[model samples]
Target: METWGFEASNVAVAQVRIEQQLVEAATRAGLTNLRVTTDSEVETIGPTQWLGAEVQANLLWTPTFAFLDALAAWPEGFRVTGFQYEMQPLTPLQQEAGMTAPTGSVRIGVAFPVILPPTAAAPAAAGAGS
Candidate 1:
């Protein structure tokens, strides 16, 4: 069994919505059997929220091929700032046993830069301004 890993970053404000859409898109693109695991952290940068996340999905097909197809079919409104793929080889014992590994497993994670949004800056008093 081949495993595929996907990492998406710099998402939009509607992170959850977009994530769901992406999953649907993947399913429509012939990746039906999908298992999803997700984690997220929020951060604030000035007014805008800078959020980052990593999503890993194991495909039933070849890892590289599935990843490429998924990447190509990714919907708009979501920018994939970064991505990576790794091939995890099966153990010798498992190979000897002639057992096929499970496929279509997905893991999603998010890492935000700032947890809390910054409050409004305090105004300076007249004396302080002087």
Candidate 2:
């Protein structure tokens, strides 16, 4: 599990880029059974509003070095808040399937921030009263 901070032109653009980066990084890291999902949020301060999002990815058979490699691939404005890992003995089915090592899942939480343009009403057309 990991957390990230990002800045983009807009929320939609940010979501697309984040998803792309995550999938690419995961592929490079050799993470199997990768699954990704995202949740969005908004925060306002004074006249400013910020778009926020969280990406959660689940994976199987992720190694330490692989995780590090994926972490390194992220560009600036991104960071890892924390991670969680658990290992358990393989079940009979898994054993028969030739699985040797412990199996577990990973959940990655990534957050993004984007500044939206200020909303305003349109001005009246000229010559309307002329």
Candidate 3:
């Protein structure tokens, strides 16, 4: 991650799984599966933790979650593996939709690689003697 210069945070090991979603028309026509998936797993990682301050790299972005979710089920150190952001007005979009909610080109999402603290299972584990 350092080599790429993209900041890495809350480092942990993550497992990623992929699934395909087939739209109704495609299913009926036996066509290819749609790229869109309803699976929520794409939005989150689990069973993760935050690294100690000693190991922190002073990253620009840190893990964050809703207040309630943080109290109940937030990972120890949630960090985004992928993200998108933009700045735009919310009122016009709301007026167009006849509803009030945040909207814009900007968006942020977390997918997979919810890093966990290194364990002793690996051959070159952290803190292992050289």
Candidate 4:
């Protein structure tokens, strides 16, 4: 089985809405067997101001490679901003038992920064009724 983690950023208004969208997108892409867990409030550490409320999802599936490929092929607007994984080697005996030991499971962590159009920017004030 394959497992992964995902994250999204720069969200406006309700965060749950964005999470639903992502889950829908994944389901539409044939990732039917999905288990998602979310945490709305989170904390960070270290000198960098690298922390914010985050929603994390863990995906599990069979035929790991195919699942990863499908995720990579997500639409342009739905960019997969970040990813990570852990590697574990299997013993020879395990391989012989018809168990396809995972070379590694990729943890996909994405940061979707909602970029509004320039026109959406704040309007400048008229200087002294020019």
Clashes of each: 2, 1, 4, 1
Q: Each model's TM-score, in the order given? A: 0.39, 0.58, 0.22, 0.39
C-alpha lDDT values of all predictions: 0.43, 0.52, 0.27, 0.39
Q: List residue ranges in candidate 2 displaced over 4 A.
A: 1-7, 42-64, 96-98, 112-130
Q: Could you tell me the lDDT of residue 112 within candidate 1? A: 30
Query: Would you list the rank order by lDDT, best first?
Result: 2, 1, 4, 3
Model 4 is weakest, by summed lDDT over 10 consecutive residues, at 43-52
Better of 1 and 4 by lDDT: 1
lDDT of 1 by residue, 46-126 (tens): 443434545566644554345446656543312344444344667788788885774334443433332222321112112
Error of model 3, residue 103, in angstroms: 0.8
Residues 83-109 of candidate 3 have per-residue lDDT tens digits of 343434567757797865443332222
Please say which candidate is ahead in TM-score: 1 or 3. Answer: 1
Instruction: Evaluate residue 104 in candidate 3 and report its C-alpha lDDT on the 0 to 100 scale.
Output: 35
The pairs that clash in candidate 1 are 37-108, 43-114
In candidate 3, position 30 carries an lDDT of 29
lDDT of 4 by residue, 33-59 (tens): 454433232211221111122223333
Displacement of the residue 109 alpha carbon in candidate 1, Å: 9.7
Model 3 bad stretches (over 4 Å): 1-13, 17-64, 71-76, 79-84, 90-97, 105-130
